[model samples]
Target chain A: MREAKKQPGIAEVAAAAGVSVTTVSHVLSGRRPVSAATRALVETVIKELGYRPNPSARGLRTQRSESIALIVPDLTNPFYTLVAAGLQDVLMESGYLLSITDAAQPGRALPEVVRHVLARRVDGIVLASYGATDDDIASIAETGTKLVRLGSRFRADFGDVVRADDVGGMHDVVDHLLARGYRRIGLVNGEYDAQPSQMRLEGYTRALREAGRTADPDLIHFGTFSRAGGAAGARRLFDSAHPPDAIVGGNDLIAVGVMDAARERGLAIPRDVAITGYDDIEAASLVTPALTTVHNPAREIGRTCARMLLDRLAGKYDDVAREVVLAHRLVIRESS
Target chain B: MREAKKQPGIAEVAAAAGVSVTTVSHVLSGRRPVSAATRALVETVIKELGYRPNPSARGLRTQRSESIALIVPDLTNPFYTLVAAGLQDVLMESGYLLSITDAAQPGRALPEVVRHVLARRVDGIVLASYGATDDDIASIAETGTKLVRLGSRFRADFGDVVRADDVGGMHDVVDHLLARGYRRIGLVNGEYDAQPSQMRLEGYTRALREAGRTADPDLIHFGTFSRAGGAAGARRLFDSAHPPDAIVGGNDLIAVGVMDAARERGLAIPRDVAITGYDDIEAASLVTPALTTVHNPAREIGRTCARMLLDRLAGKYDDVAREVVLAHRLVIRESS
Candidate 1:
């Protein structure tokens, strides 16, 4: 193997071609569509820079296991499983097998899981981490292992990020509820420290302000992402001297719990307390007075992560971290 | 490495020790509890029979990538995910990372998925196969890889079987519904070829016979396991000349769809019509009038599969295939 420091890299080739590194990558990998003229220029630059695309690296790639590992916080959560489904569908088509492991299991934290996956020498890794530190990610990259971060737990600069627009999704949710003439709306969010929860809170506040209603801190309650958490938040709001006319769950599971709490108190859904949730999980529609919620594109996000990781493995680009934000939609059902 | 043809294996040692192969295995692995006296006798017999456990085999075991792969029909289903969760919890405690793959994805048939998993040389495989054939089982076994068959898709003689009691569970559901004085019960099952569907249908028939009522052919409907299938089946039963007084779903998803069908017809649950379902998944309780369903121990079944597979990998037993059937119970909620 030639010394990497002396060998010209893809960056040099891109610079000589006067095109983005990504364009140069696309020209090499042929993974994405590129203009014919741009492709020709990039091919010429590659030969001029003596950027021999690492013959030894190509040899190693041939011996590659052609398997990808996905580490998720909760395997039982439908959102994560749906993501796994999408990821598997795409990877399977390209002759790559996807191995999904869980991070929430005892003694199998994110760092520990990463070590085991790295030890297996998978071609790449997709991590849906909530508390992964910089060191955790750096360790994987340092090994020349392609990596893609799922969700908004880390900044875009950290690595390739594939996630839904949490802020915009939540903003749409609140605006929809307010438009229905529901005053004193309460938000029951997941743990406050989690980036998704924080972003959702920001969306709720912005929507409230845009509607000429001052955001009430008293109406905000944060808890775990389970039904128990949502129920606890709903109870707190219900017990307050001034309960909100509507309650919004951070996710479907929490929203289901809020409904449970309301029912326990003999409160009829929609008639007594309008309810809404995020992540239009099957349970949302299964519940009576089916929940009005945001349809977070979890499956699409998973597919995007697989594509991004595949691109990296194909030697597409080694530039700064890239990000892909999927779209979200409001699914209005009977609850509102 | 010594030639295996000239060496005494675990079976020979067990025969000379006058003990069961499993007992000798237990003494060797120390994974399960065994008496000290039995352990001493087994060790002594090993020395007398010149039965040297292959050192090369031991070295290979040491070099094994401590990871297991799980292949399920559908990754998006909560039942499989819950099982994966249970499997992960037990495997993690033993320092084993589990990689889950889906067989239902396009271009990723069961055999193809198995080939990829085998190519990666996983320590063991846990397959929740629906249509796997004898060739599939023989191929995995021929590789000298540890295997555990999840679900009732295959017979116990084929390999290690870990599954819930589908027949007994469905029987209990029927008995409960009968006790509630609901006559003219119709069953909507999954595909006719599936072992679970067959077993469940048998249970439903046996219950009807014991109650001195014959199962009407028109009352039996077969469809896919999704919500649309359930709803379609329910609609058929509803439009029949003699609509069933109650409907039973093969699984919870189908039951939710049955609920949808009833709602579309403006029928009040348990009043104008009664409903029941199998697999008391999260959606069972989340749905209105909660679901009267069988509580399938999917997670426990998953845990059992992991333990069984680990025992095999530990060289505990290589005799005839083993089987473990977990228990199931009927959960009578309001929907009944």
Candidate 2:
């Protein structure tokens, strides 16, 4: 029994049950009809022998890879991972697997990624952070593959988009900073060409205009959406002849960099130069003085995106040109 | 022409070529032979239609699912995402799709997860940051699936294991802290049974003993491997009458919590209370008083695990069972 158990294969089960491999597969999957006597014998043999069909073999008939793709702008950032967790949760429940791709590499490889996902024939695709160009988005829309964009907004006439209210969220942060008596506010922005960066910069400028404060071009520094970029930006801000009293970074990593820059210059947070960040990642709460930042709903965005894609795949939504904007919150900690 | 280019279906390609769907499929996939003239005509029509095979349709083949599974403890941690990125880098090159699952939820649902992965028939499985019990591991091994463990060392009669030098790495951290003149050191550990936690604890004790210092039971606290747990453990350490002058956490998240605890108590790091952490995640560098921690080779570990699994699948190294232990480094920062 032990020897037989050690080498339990489909052939052993088929032979034991007096059936062929095809017959066994037909009985197991019920893709075709089989005699009750033969079915019962196969079932008994399968149960007794602990016979399991190779997954690779069974996958051939379903025409469903049962997998999806998750493309994020960066993996080093904790925010995307949290979003990934949420997406994985929902997709796993529906028996779909997720493949993750980083979009922040050189050239931002979205086109190649799209081709790979298509080649693998994934059930759907989730764009976690990359903003799709018109051409790419249009192609995806035409391909009839379900797509959900996370933390990004696009004009493409395809797929549902899940985004946080960056404008409103930034407004809250600016208002709170003002209420806290931070007058000379500086903005550490990301690349101006990116949609989120543009929206955030606009929000900053709009808030300053509303508050009767001139938006100083010198106060704004543009860099990559990263901690080093934030650090460098902070250095530039500090080097300026007229340093702002408070700095608002494009995202939390930049905020952390600004904090590092402040500490390097012997400046204290909130006491000497207040700082704030966006995307309220896990690091926001873990950083010293904790970080006063805008809470972008990363996980919620991911879950909503996955659910939206699943809905689209299941024909729950007929219109592909739908947008779902999620809400973001402003969390004030010691930095402000 | 533009409208025709917008929708490329197999039927359109077949109709354009005046061939049956089966003939077109056979011609395109090379499953069976067709006349040269018909094949050439079908190819031209396929190109004209811009027809791409639906991955869902191709997935129905039994021999190759072209999908893989990545199981991790949590994605909220940046380390796992980094590892995921490395795994994706390799798997993507081979045209395999990936699905990720978080096993941190209560009860972990390992059996269900196994069944799901089996049903999908992933070409292989990668286990990261999580470990399976003997029975569960044995069951998976019995199924003849190619399995690889990342950042974990477990020997089963079947499957491969990959791990980092946890004991040696912890010793490096402890020695560094000791060299920095930190005595009366405390240890903040994860759940007692976790593999890394147990190994780290052993190294901590061994280091203290080697330094001719008696181990203080009161200085050790076990908590969840999270920031909250670290915070709680730090509070316990400080609230005690004999608060240690230094603290070592099992991981970076716990160390971040300890840093918070020190700030709340007004203890100056590296002066009043030096702290060290393990797993040099991004936050370890970004946090205030940048964390001095052990740098586990996360990406290397992930890449090595993938290679090991691929080698097993390819029938390489059949005669010998082997283990690969990667090296780790201690990154010194402001915290200690």
Candidate 3:
């Protein structure tokens, strides 16, 4: 493993630079000021010799892993992947490594997951769009791990929460559909228990009332937050005696499902049944008809979440219990 | 940080089980023979107390990090995310952690990335379709870092390689398209430099020749392995003086682009033009007029790649280089 010969140690660096060990340590650790010429000479030697500080040794001295864990519900979802990528971009810049875990799998106990991360002693954590029981949240908080919630707002008093404008974004999608002469619009929503699902539904109804359109409860269908769920709900809508002329999906996945349902039923998109989805995931544009949907700043949410966690770790815990709401927009395409 | 009381150690277990420290150590590490009754007693106490052997202590004694690095080209691609998830599933079971890195960013230095991973002293590495240059490979190999290539084959002496059945899968897709009575098929391909891209193109030409169909050079388009590239190629095909009746995308992203182009141009799928894609990613089904394409076990590929690296690390390197060729199948959907 040491084919290139052992890298020079700090002692060797100090000797080579003709400086005392104490002075070299002060210059390298930035503990005290050193002469400009001496500092430059030491830095040059360090760089030229390719000296890398041992992580284990530094970890022992700093009592920090210089790493963080990103816990998400699922990675198969493009939205989560994009968010994770965003988090990596910011965290990697600060010389911090990211360890990712998917909490969606069964049989892998959450407590064990927490313990494993704790054993690593990461400086912080970024939880992305995943639900945890109240007890779980309390346990994590009590463990003294700096936590930041992304997309899912929960236990406001426990940690920093970063989210997108889901309610407003949904309203934009619904209003756009109405403005496009789409009447009798059907809604394929997510699980009613989830916060995003309820908020989106509220936005949908608000937009309908503003348009002087009576909200039809029968036209609303709730299912899992997945493509299959959207397909199932869309099928039910199409089988109804009075099928809707257009469908509004809770997110891009559901909208994609709505598209699938229309195809299976031999319905022409935007002609026989216009469809709209939210989140504006990468798939939204790739799908046929390029789903007209709302663009949620997933990557930005991740960056903000990481920065919030970093701030907390830096002892800025009293920075108020604020919610960082990033901008979202409605991207009009062919679907609607 | 150690606020909780320290858990009982091996000495306490020996005291409780009425055994010597050596006997307990033998039973725990399976290093030496111990009476069955004594072994059972020690095991019971170990399980009852939920005692975990200290990984750091064990690592110190074994001279290993008990960790590995997984280098992928991109994580925004759902395919790679699934692969990462799969690799994590297997590695986590063995008490090994994964460090994931995305190498697709422009101006990203590979040597620095390799050095960073090596600095962490990861026990092995899994390079996923990264197209690593010879120098990069040589540098990592020189460090004695066990390496495995996923979704790409390397020189026989390079290391373990896991590749999908690209040629066979492409042939199946092209045959299905030709059987649908479509001629003048356009090939939307990925970077021509990639091995899979070249193999897939060969399959397409072979199928056309066997069907007594002339391959039109003008119908071939090459782009990056992304949905936008696919869409761009589809647009060019549509603008051509004579547009093809069908398009075969090298992968799912390109196929998605083709769908978007058709929708933008108001071309009815299958009626005006039929399209088929490869990979059959999760998006393939959710999109409107679900894509007809080939399915590659991306997650399985990742899992297999990790396993091979583990085997290599366990001193199982042999003269007969092991190669795992996973199966691929064509999935028919509404698009065709």
Best by lDDT: 1
lDDT of 1 at A300: 88
- Tens-digit lDDT string for candidate 1 (A144-242): 677788766546556688878888998998899888889999999998776778888888999999999987888999997788899999999999888
lDDT of 3 by residue, A251-270 (tens): 88998888889989999989
iRMSD in angstroms, per model: 17.7, 5.4, 4.4
lDDT-wise, the better of 1 and 2 is: 1
The best-first sequence of candidates by DockQ reads 2, 3, 1
Chain B, candidate 3: TM-score:
0.89
DockQ of each: 0.16, 0.36, 0.32
The TM-score of candidate 3's chain A against the true chain A comes to 0.90
Two-way TM-score contest, 1 vs 3, winner? 3
**Which ranges in model 3 have alpha carbons more than 4 Å from their true place?**
A1-28, A34-38, A109-112, A177-186, A205-220, A236-247, A262-274, A318-322, B1-61, B107-112, B178-185, B206-217, B234-245, B261-274, B318-321, B334-336
lDDT of 1 by residue, B20-84 (tens): 98998789779898899999999999878746443224324454546788998888778989889
Total clashing pairs for each candidate: 0, 11, 0
| Model 2 docking grade | acceptable
Question: How does each model score on TM-score?
Answer: 0.80, 0.85, 0.85
